[model samples]
Target: MMLGLKTLLLFGLGGQELLLIALIVLLLFGGAKIPELMRGMGKGVKSFKEGMKEVDEVKKDIENEVKKDEE
Candidate 1:
């Protein structure tokens, strides 16, 4: 299981491979646009996290209500 997890995380990528990928992204997006792209991605991730937290809170509330009814 650990080995599988490691393989999934790295996908066997080495330093050179990662550097090449970064270069490709820089070339495709150019120097000026990368920061904007990253900022949008960061915002998207933050929104996703907040949505997940709200879902978890609602789930806990429902569970608590169920417990109250049982009592």
Candidate 2:
């Protein structure tokens, strides 16, 4: 699933604006913490994708059962 916040953020941001934001983040978090933050984000994304897949599977199973009952 697409992240709504990500889509909303940076929608009309230009290159200069992006650079400014990056610089601010670097100053706030420092260089060393950025990698750790990105790694954690990656794990979160992976978990979210897995959860979505399971939801899809359950939905399909429910639909199939309903179809079988109709026959």
Clashing pairs in 1: none
User: For this target, which candidate reaches the highest lDDT against the unseen true structure?
Assistant: 1
lDDT of the structure predicted as candidate 2: 0.86
lDDT of each: 0.87, 0.86
Q: Highest TM-score among the candidates is held by which one? A: 2
Q: Per-residue CA lDDT of candidate 1, range 27-48, in tens?
A: 9999999999989988997899
Off by over 4 Å in 1: 1-9
Q: What's the CA error at residue 7 for candidate 2, in Å?
A: 4.9
| Candidate 2 lDDT trough over 10 residues, lowest sum | 1-10
